[model samples]
Target chain A: MYSVEELVWNDSFINWVRYNKNSDFWESLRASDPAVEENIRKAALIVKAAAATPEIPVEESEAAEVWNRIRRDTAEPETGNRKWHWAVASVAAAFLVFLGIYNYGKTDTRVSYENLISEVASSDYKEIRNDGPDPVSVSLPDRSSVVLYQGSKIGYSLSGYNREKREVYFSGEGFFEVSKNPQKPFFVYSNELITKVLGTSFTIKAPENSEKIEVIVKSGKVEVITRKDPRKKKVLESKELEEGNYLVENQKIDLERATMKLSPIVKRELTELNHAVQQMKFDFDEEPVTRIIADLELAYNVRISYDKVKWQGTKLTAHLSDEPLYDKIEMICKAIEAEYEVRPDKIVIK
Target chain B: MTRLWRSFIAGDEDAFSEIYEAFFKILYRYGYHFAADHSLVKDAIQELFTDLWRLRSNLSDTTSVKFYLFRSLRRRLHTLAGGEDVYQALPLSENDLRGLQTDSREQYLIDKETEEIHLKQLGEGINKLTTRQREALRLKYYEGFTLSEAASIMNMNEQSVRNLIQRAIISLRSLLS
Candidate 1:
């Protein structure tokens, strides 16, 4: 008969206790050695108890928050020295030039906006056409909102909108407020330029007849890359774009159709024409806490719950434009001497 | 999981997120065990994933993603904790004992009144173990990793890990009696 410690240390016994595996073998052993049955039971209990060690619970919101930080950190272009891949790429490019076979591998994979739309026309893509005189709002399946300008159109696969990735094809001008989802990147394919973001508000102007497609970043980081180049087609290249081609808050990138070149412009003055999402003022001067909370809820598309009666007369005065949504909440909570808990679906202020 | 890792290495954003979702909690729990600091553990995990993403091209496929992440997070937490000895024995807090009791009661589906006293004693006995002993038991029995896998994670020989666990169980039995 095996000792309790021997049974406890056995891998098969542990597996059986934890997952109910190898039951036949365990049952035969128990039947053959009835004297070891008690030892077996005790060992199983020990394994179960050991596995039941209390774990630090990680809330869904907490995981998402950390993920957002990771996404943001990784999305930023690696500062200083070119990454190894770029070094290899440059060396290979130079070698190709030396071999005089560069032009032989140059294949033009560019497609027009009309062709792109027609290709998706047969699919079950939900197409939103703004025939109205003014810009109309379009809400996507992933809670991302798009303000489609007159004579503009946006289409996305209804089935795959938020499942794998949030992808949308657009023509003409539109202001996009994409919801934060680091796992599923938000992709806006407009003309020759594709603007990718984890979660950010931006404006894409890609008129069907315009020579230049523009991406204006109102807030958060935005990556604009040429849609035609297969080498740079992978969304992972957002890291590479951070080095040279990515757009940050208040910056803009204009993609020339003729040359397929990206020119990033640092716009100091964000006019009303380009900065659509930034119109919502985050700077508050003695604003009622209720109003400020409502604005935050509207801006971030998150619900903030608290005792209305307790905070009826609370007011906030702070410049929150430069801070992230969570930081802004933290600052507000600090001013009010309150603690905020991030739940799965909502933020609770106590 | 291997498919997801391969896709992540191939620059698939969705796969990267999938891997993160799959491993975040377990990594968090393991990191917490190493160091109780909430933000510190969170930062270690965050940096671990960030580095993984940054060096994804250099990473090879692993059959056991959990073991790989656990090793990475352990190394990271060790460094972030300023090279403090993670094997050093730590006094179990009252909260930990209470948490153990509740967890065991819920997991075993046993008669609560009858098992409470015994489970409490078991928890105390388990808690009295050295951090190394607890970690070895945790990796072997709780996580269900193979002996060699646990030894590798603990940076010790398999026989040494086996001895540590045997000693831990003997001590627990003595304490229980």
Candidate 2:
């Protein structure tokens, strides 16, 4: 018979119990010394409870942003000594200027061919995951952009077919802001469905272990088509989607309601306008809290507050990065000689 | 080994990211438990990973990459703490200072001291054994190597690995109790 302390600290016995789970020694030990074994089990329970609880330490997204900046800074220009093995001068630069001239009055309906070309990756594509509440930018050669959400993978052929029509595949979920180019449409193949859109913003997801492909548009229209389906014969009978707004491939089309908001014209207009605004850029030169808060409100069109109204006068003047909506608030508060607590929907200025 | 070595050495960013991602959490946990500073751990892990990437050409002779990483981390921790004093004393906050007058900070200090004592106890318990015995325990438990793998890694016989593990556990039990 062992004392409670003796049995609890028995490493071999504990290891045996930890690994085997239903070992006979535990039963025998419990029978011989109930109190000791009970303590051992209680201690195990404490360790197990601590292990089970997820303790995520919160750090500012500054680390991630810094890492990104480092990676970008290290690319090509910064590392002039190291010649880029796969680097090619992107035509997206020229395309941007062309679009600027072409879209003087009209909304640019053409997603830049340059943006489409940018998607032509040279490296072997593999699974990508972004496990944080921030947007991850992947530049396609055509200057089209993809923002992968928290847990998503975007796979594409980088070697054998890299220069071709930019064939890329995706699974899980992601948002795409395609550079407008009417000549070459951007294609995202997932599961059995293919989403083809020319110069538009949209999201597509084909979750693991699920058969359905979910396509949702935030800006421009997308045509979803079935690549391989038993119902292909039926689909071939008619041009299933004569610009019928939104669609689900291989699935029955509810021909009744096809909604179209923000026509191609309006979308072009908005993109041009947004692009110009993005160029103008916003800077706060180490301004006071009150001033920064006012600037942020004007920029993002959101209201901000401090723990005390008097705290507003506290000053902060730092060049703000293109941070997420909430992080900006946090930074503003931090600058102003105060801390801000985050609420579910808003920030509590403290 | 040569194939993976070549892939990594060729500046394959994906390969680097994959290896880094797999060991990142474990390294982070070990670093956090030892250094008690998050930023320091992050920096150490980054340095470790970059070194690993640079030294990929030598991977063929090195078996048990996980063991190598742990040993390196331990050495780094030892250097960071400096000399023999293991525990780091963190600064007290304004709230804690105020609580000291009310005896609350004293209570917290007591609890923290107790936790530090247990952590030291655990470390010392493992340290009591011979190098072989300690290696066996570390490989089997922390690194999750099988008995045969541990034997292979330690370049010892299988029975020797088992015997060493058993002896190490018994010694730790005595020390811990």
Best candidate, DockQ-wise? 1
Q: For candidate 1, write residues A1-350 as lDDT tens digits.
A: 57887888787887777777897998678767656765775665566556655646788777887886787678755354422212211100000000011122222544556666665645777888977554555667766667667677899876767777778888866767666677888777776677777776665666665665666665577776787656555663333335555666555656666667767566624342432223565677898898788766654445577656588897879876534456667889999999998655357788
Report, to 2 decimal places, the DockQ of model 2. 0.02
Q: What class would a CAPRI assessor give candidate 1's docking?
A: incorrect
| RMSD to the hidden true structure, all candidates | 22.6, 23.6
**Global lDDT of each candidate:** 0.67, 0.46
Residue-level lDDT tens digits of model 1 in B135-163 = 88888887778888888888789999989
Off by over 4 Å in 1: A31-33, A76-350, B87-115, B175-177
Number of backbone collisions per candidate? 0, 23
DockQ of each: 0.19, 0.02
Q: Candidate 2: where are CA atoms >4 Å away?
A: A1-94, A98-350, B1-12, B60-62, B77-177
Q: Is the docking of candidate 2 incorrect, acceptable, medium or high quality?
A: incorrect
When candidate 1 is compared with the true two-chain complex, its DockQ is 0.19
